[model samples]
Target: MSADRPELDRCSRCGECRAVCPVFRETRRETDVARGRLLRYRLARDAGRFSAADREAFSRCLLCGRCLEACKAQVDVPALMQIAKTDSGFAAGWPSLLTEKTLADDGRLDAAVRRYRSLSRWLGRATPDDSGLRLRFALPYLDAGRLYPKPPARGYLEQHTGRRASGVQKLAFFAGCGAGRLLTGVGEAVDRVLAELNLTAAIPEQACCGLAAWGIGATDAARRTAIAWVRSFAGEEYDAILSPCASCTAHLQTRLPQILAGTEFAADAARLAAKVEDFFAWLSRQDLCFDLAGLKVGAHVPCHARREVRDGAAFVSFLKKSGAELVKIDERLDAQCCGMGGSFGVLHPELSRRIGLPKVAALRAAGAAVLVTNCTGCLWQLRDLAARFDPALPVRHPVELLDR
Candidate 1:
């Protein structure tokens, strides 16, 4: 495989991925799909043949890993996309801005969350008839819409400490940026489940899992962020590291070990991989049970979970065991991308929505009252989509279901 174009060279151009690639199905443009992108990247690498505009197109992909799942040739689309991003010098666009604003400094994130907390409380005090609440009634942007269950009060990591549990097993919580900042409820639910297992969790002040940075060709940023996280967690030792963020879990389980290999943190990375368990996987192995009486649920496994861990199916088993009626969304569960590929939804909203429609349809067809997924990005997009389609179709992180 070519160093600069490993994925491009590895992709066999089998065209097998076309049927399952959401972007391909939408635009029907070859270059918009993984294979064509790989071919172009390969050509660019070998022949010095890419225009600046073409390089920008390469960064447009969601890096969802759906094509990798469909490929009989076993191509690593996300890895290859990372290589492309690194070689192309493209930033993750809106996510880059968001990252710089939120992740560039943890102090800012904390301060921002404090402000959000204040706003949330102030908004809660107002009735629909109040001046503050009524001011946004006529404005489209201000009425951006409210989420169901109103988001959680505190992130899971905020509620726990490393010494919370004294028991047979312990875990360190890796609440990826999305979970810590955006999906606090999911993080809290994870904490509840961890408590049920009698395992204390170390809520470390870690950086983003570096998945977003890697996806957008921010290689140095990704590495620096990852190294910082590793350094922050340098002295801590736990039986395992766990996260409810499926994409974060996948990247940590698969990519981080490779990135940190032969470095001072290599052993820590390997240890984390060994200890890292998807929430459902751990739940399945435990004897704990949830009071999911009369609950009807459906699951959408993220492409990263499907391609990297392939154990998201354990969620189905776990749900079934908890007495929830598990509605199967896709028979193969290998449906096309959810369209909210990490930062893809922000970068190309129209394309993301176009690709997301099918996934939304699949969940609607399942007819379950609630949809559950383990990925933060999937939860965000699917939740937004559910509100757009029918505010009644509630979307949740699986940990939320387990918590309930």
Candidate 2:
């Protein structure tokens, strides 16, 4: 094993990750844990080649960043996994190609979603609550029983582009793909909340945050997407850039600059990164009263919130101040990934389900009236899980509570 990749070499073969890994807990496979994956990467690097099995092993990760949190050595397993995936050409195939193409082009993705919305209306059955449609038959990528949010007829950016509000401070809203496309209600809720605070924000026309592409090792595609995203907001001067999606907030504040480093957009990326703020963090600082007097809320903290934005605690505190009765679950499940690792759920549905089921069950068992998470991906995944467990249970973003 080569020592050049210090991340891989830093692994002390500590099995702490095995105990915390959702995949390993279900599969009980050593290779499914971060330590085992690091060992595999070292051996593959030593041989100067990554086998098909090596590629598969690297792709199995949820990139939830749990192992890094647990590791005393601070080995960056997710970063190493991305490197291994890129080296093995694992992301060059089917789904990655599809994501790279669709997400990198705003017009193309919008057209694709419009077509999906049309098809969904034609072939899918509406749920009783009108939350979304349940497919009657499975498509190539969609499962027959899957429950997905109905995208708005007009996306957030499509409707609100160039729209600005009047306030003392200038703020910009970055509605990532989930809020901009699939769940425009979340974006609307954010606007309503901002108005309530007497704060204003400019809704900019932005593309995907590139976290999905980067997670799948489509580095070039991710870089291009980041450049385009940065260009969209660089022309304006704002006190801060806010994103309701925890994953988008984290990637913008952390990974955007990394991807754009050395490029002409690098300085602009850094400037935007410095101004990026998570919605939960921003909301916590506001001096507004929330009147959720009788709601029982189950909060699922996103991994990015726990590790990057560090707003999970503040969000929980805000929920308490809102007078909502907080449902209790095992503390161990606090920062667990909802298994909606963007492309991970699409590529490995069963594994994603295995990891998410337990967390969802814990919340359900605790008698939560509603489930709330800050990440758009977590909101979607938990809604799907909640629908299967009990359709009456509503999964929502935290800002939605404020909208009420």
- Highest-scoring model, TM-score: 2
* Residues forming the 10-long window of minimal summed lDDT in candidate 1: 127-136
Clashing pairs in 1: 85-217
Write candidate 1's Cα lDDT for 35-58 as tens digits.
Answer: 888877777877755577666667
How far does residue 361 in candidate 2 sit from its true spot (Å)?
2.0
| Deviating ranges (above 4 Å) for candidate 2 | 1-4, 95-101, 128-130, 310-313
Which parts of model 1 have CA positions greater than 4 angstroms off?
1-7, 10-12, 47-50, 92-105, 111-165, 330-334
Per-candidate Cα RMSD to the true structure, in Å, reads 4.7, 2.3
Which TM-score value belongs to model 1?
0.84
TM-score, one value per model = 0.84, 0.93
